[model samples]
Target: MMQRTISTTKHWIVIVLMSVLGCGLLIQGGYMQAKAHFAQFLIERAFEQTLVDNQPHKPWSWADTHPVAKMRVLQQQTDGFQPLGSDLYVLAGASGRNLAFGPGLMLGGAGLGEQGNTIIAGHRDSHFMRLQYVKLGDIIELYSTEGERVLYQITATEVVHETDMKVLAPTAEKHLTLITCYPFDQLSGNAEYRYIVEAKPIDAQPLYS
Candidate 1:
């Protein structure tokens, strides 16, 4: 009888441990989802303010990050053109926390809408997830803080080692480079490769005018 009681106790202990682990996983997932939604909300507000004031705008009062640019993927057709998805706000720096919120414009690169290479980095599972669907010849529009909208056409997409620096090289012509982790579906802790998208300016005129 005592052996049976001990066996029953062991079973209950196992059940309790599993229950705690399962609850932990659920809470973690929910927190992450909430964080992503909140970040996007902040970004949207910043983007709107930037457009209204024609100046850089911070998403929140205490945030060190500010919206530097707005990006949209354009879908062109014989009859008309439309944006593929909602606008994504580009943040000032690509720190891990910043990327969790939005795409980050690399410092020391060409200023937005300028005549040099501009590099931006975003997380694969979040802000840059749609980049996988971007194809050659697809048009990308960048709205800068100065209220200038520039059009660019995708020229190339490639995968390179994470340490490759050539992809960020400076150029005399206007260019936009997007960097994200490769194998978009992978959930690994260490991302060894990067997916890069290069676009060249096709129009110099401001989009709004």
Candidate 2:
């Protein structure tokens, strides 16, 4: 009789442990999904505000980052490569915390529409996933907070070690640089490589409204 009671207690303890683990996983998954959705909403609001006011706008009261520009890739074929889509919100500052919310502009780099290089970075799983499809000669439209829209033609794409700092170097002419982690479909662990896209301004006039 004592053996039976001990066995039953052990079984119940195992069941309780499993239940707790399941609940923890469920909560984590739910929170991640919710965060992704909320980040998109925040980006959209910030983009709209920048367009309407022609000034930097924060998505939320507590946000340390603000919308600095809006970017879209042209759908036309460029060197036999066509991008999937052309809509992205550019946020100020590219810290890990800022990137969790959306694509961020590197703070020390030149501002959008400036004469030097402007570097932007986004998460591989979310904001920059579409970058994998971008190809040479594809046009990228960047709208700045000053109500100026500049067009950039993609000139190059490369994979480099994460420690390569040359990718972020300032240019003598206007340029746009995008950075994201490599191996977009990785299931686990941080990637050691980075995927980079480089573009040069093509038009002097603001083409996008």
Candidate 3:
């Protein structure tokens, strides 16, 4: 009789342990869901601000004109973007609620329209949650302090290790490279691999009031 009672006690213990583990997992999943949702909201807000806050440029193309004409070229200068000076961009990746955390704007360069590549990074989990759905040839539009809009076309999307910042380096030609945590497999913290989206300037359209 005693042995049977002990067996029953052990069974109850196992059941309790299982229940605890299950509940822990449930709580963790909910936390992650909430975080991703918040990240999505942040990205949307940032994108909108970027569009509204870009600077304006006076349109004057000086080619093969005289030096006097160059001085005559006084175009209207528009407001430009104020750089965060950090590579921590709010991602707008996942189409749904995933933030798709990746990199934001970093140092050593100006905004989108100058020379070289302007690389941005965000988290695969939080900011870049939706990057998985991005296809080749998609458009990435950013506004600058000059009130000008910079256009980019996704030229390549790749997966690399965290050590591979080489692809994210500035190029001789203008481009925009987005870096984010890869796989999005982890429920929390940073990922091992990186997801990179490389884009180039395609076309531009003037924004008029």
Pairs with backbone N, CA or C atoms under 3 Å apart (clashes), candidate 1: none
Candidate 2 versus the native: TM-score?
0.77
Prediction 1 TM-score vs. true: 0.81
Question: Residue 152 deviation, candidate 2, in Å?
Answer: 0.7
Highest-lDDT candidate: 1
lDDT (10s digit) by residue, model 1, range 20-126: 99999778867765786688788878888878887777788888889888888875565555676678888998888888788899987888888889999988876
Q: Which regions of candidate 3 fall more than 4 Å away from where they truly are?
A: 1-103, 108-110, 145-147, 188-190, 204-209
Per-model TM-score, in order, reads 0.81, 0.77, 0.58
Q: Is candidate 1 or candidate 2 better by TM-score?
A: 1
Candidate 2 pairs with clashing backbones: 72-86, 73-86
Clashes of each: 0, 2, 44
Per-residue C-alpha lDDT of model 3 across residues 11-59, encoded as one tens digit per residue: 9999999999999998887787576555434544444444555422211
lDDT for residue 175 in candidate 3, whole number 0-100: 80
Ranking by TM-score: 1, 2, 3
Which regions of candidate 1 are displaced past 4 Å? 1-30, 76-80, 204-209
Cα deviation of 54 in candidate 1 (Å)? 4.3
- Per residue, candidate 2 scores C-alpha lDDT tens digits across 67-158 of 78777876454244344554677888999988887789998899988889999998887778888887787777877776677888889999
Q: State how far residue 122 of model 3 sits from its true place (Å).
A: 1.3
